[model samples]
Target: MKITLLTVGKTEDAYLKDGIEKYVKRLKHYTKLELIDMPELKNTKALTQEQQKSKEAELIMKKVQPLDFLVLLDEKGAELTSTQFAAYIDKRQIGSTSHIIFVVGGPYGFDASVYQRANDKLSLSRMTFSHQMVRLFFVEQLYRAYTILKGEPYHHS
Candidate 1:
């Protein structure tokens, strides 16, 4: 199974880039992990929150493939332990999942249409995180899950 991380905006921090790169290299050992960066909505200060989400949603939806399993990373979504996440990955592979896409929406969150398209929702933390930070956290968690699955020393119980 392949995992694709779709998130809005670019990760500008050098530290975050380095950290994400580390996990991306590690995740390659287990499954194909691709990162898709959605461009930020331009001049959105004039638009209302809802309008901004609607505009961003259009861009996000363009990246969605009919066969991809859309999973939104939202604070309101189900939270899972690292082990459980690894199990989730194993289950998807067993079920012959072609693509698993985890999306991090823009600041105001996803539109109703985006939510409707999602197969599942997952939360990295109950506490809020910036969309850019979520990319790093999610990639790191993916790496940790693989390490747990493979009995590697990277993840400590």
Candidate 2:
């Protein structure tokens, strides 16, 4: 299955960018992966948080296709262990899923429409992290999940 990670704004820190790139390179051998960083909304000084989310939702939806399985990386979503997340990825592959889009919404989180369209939601942690930080964390977890699936030494219980 192809996995697409769609997030808002660019990852600025050199360390974070390097870390994410490292895992993404390793992931190339495992599956098709795409990283889409939608440009941050410009001139938002006048827009309300809800309005920002609404505009961000439009961009998020545009990347998603009708057949793609949308998974929102939401704080309130189901939390899974590394091994469990590996199984989740395995299950998707076995189920013949062609495309799975995992979205990291804007700072205020997803709008009602984005939530409505999601097929599933997953929480990386109960604690909140900056959206930029989330990008690195999610990619690393995804890489770990693959290694777990292959019984590699990269992950230990």
Candidate 3:
């Protein structure tokens, strides 16, 4: 199964961009992983938080295909251990999910439509992190999960 990570806006910080790139390269050894940066909405200074999310949601939905399983990275979603996350990926593979698309929403979070379209939601932590930072964190965790699945020393029990 292919794994795709969808995020809004670019990673402006050079350090964060470098870190995300490192993990993306490592993840290529395990699965077909793709990271897509959805363009930020223009003229957002005038739009409300809800309006911004709605506009972002439109771009997010466009990237999804009919067979893709949508998973939103949300604060209120399920929290799992590293091993559990690996098991989760195993389950998806067993179920023959074509593409597992994990989305990190914009600054104000996801719109109602985007939430409704999601098949599942996962939380990295209860505390909030910047959307750009989350991109790095998620990619690293995804790599760690694969290592755990392979019984490698990259992850410890």
Candidate 4:
């Protein structure tokens, strides 16, 4: 199965960019992983938080296919251990899920439409982190999950 990570805006921090690139390269050895950055909405000073989310949701939905299994990375989503995450991926593969799209929404989080479209939601941690920072954290966790799945030494319980 192919895994796609869709997030809004770019990663401007040099450290975060480097980390994200490293994991993306390492993840290629395990599965087809794609990271797509949706451009940030322009002139958001006048828009309310809901309005921003609405516009961002429109952009996000444009890239989603009808059959793709959408998963949102949100604070309120289910939290799982590294091994459990690997198991989740294995289950999806066995079920013949063509594409698993994990989305990181804009600062205000996802709109109601995006929430309704998602098949599942996952949380990296209970604490808050910047949206850009979350991109790096989630990618690293994904890599860790793969390593754990393969019984590699990268992850220790």
Candidate 5:
């Protein structure tokens, strides 16, 4: 199964970008992992929060394929341990999922329309993290999940 992380905006910080890239490289060794960055909405100061989210959702939805299993990284979502997350990934690969897409929405979060399109929701932690930081965290978690699955020494109890 191919794993894709779909996020809005570019990683402007050099450190964060480098860190995420490192995890992405590691993930490629275990899975066909890729990052799809949606362009951030420009000149949105005049738009209401809902309008901004609507526009962002439109951009996000366009990137998704019909067969892709969409998973949103939402605050009000299920939280899984590293082992459980590894198991989940394993199940998807074994079940032959065509594509597994995880989306980190814009500042105000996803619109109702985008929520409707999601196949599942996952939360990394109850505490909030910046959008850019969340990207790095999720990618690292994904790399860890793969290492755990492979029984590698990268992850330990």
Candidate 6:
């Protein structure tokens, strides 16, 4: 299955960008992965949290195709171990799924519309991380998941 990681805003830190690139490069061997950075909204001083999320929702919806399996990287979502995640990825590859789009939303999190559209929700940890950091962590975990799936030594139980 082809995987797409669609996130809000560009990864600014040089180190973080490099880290994401490293795993993304390794991931090419396992599956096709696409990285999309949605532009951050400007002039947010006047908008309420809900309003910001609502506006962001509009942008998010535009990128989503009717057939894409959407997954949100949310704080309240199910948390899985690396091995379990591997199984999760493997399950999709075994199924008729063609595209899996994982979204990392902006600071206030996803709006109701985005939630309603999502097929699944996954949490990297119980603790919250920045949107930028989540991108890196998610990609690395994705790489780890693929490695685990391949029975590679990169991940150890």
Provide TM-scores for the models: 0.96, 0.98, 0.97, 0.97, 0.96, 0.98
lDDT of 4 by residue, 1-157 (tens): 8999999999999999999999999999999999999999999999999999999999999999999999999998999998999999989988979999999999999999999999999999999999889999989998998998889999988
Q: Among all windows of ten consecutive residues in candidate 6, which has the lowest summed lDDT?
A: 126-135
Model 6, 30-77: lDDT tens digits are 999999999999999999999999999999999999999999999888
What is the C-alpha lDDT profile of model 5 across 1-157, one tens digit per residue?
8889999988889999999999998888998988988988999999999999999999988989898989999998899999999998998888868899999999999999999999999999999998899999999999999999999999889
> Model 3, residue 131: what's the lDDT?
84
Question: How well does candidate 4 match the true structure, expressed as C-alpha RMSD?
Answer: 0.8
lDDT of 2 at 82: 93
lDDT of each: 0.90, 0.95, 0.94, 0.94, 0.93, 0.94
Candidate 3 positional error at 19, Å:
0.9
Candidate 1 lDDT over 94-135, as tens digits, reads 896889999999998899999999999999999988777888
TM-score of 3: 0.97
Residue pair clashes in candidate 6: none
Clashing pairs in 3: none
Query: Alpha-carbon error at 38 in model 4, in Å?
Result: 0.5
Q: How high is the lDDT of residue 37 in model 5?
A: 88
* Candidate 5: regions farther than 4 A off: none
- Cα lDDT tens digits, model 2, 1-157, are 9999999999999999999899899999899999999999999999999999999999999999999999999987999999999999999999978999999999899999999999999999999999889988998999999999999999989
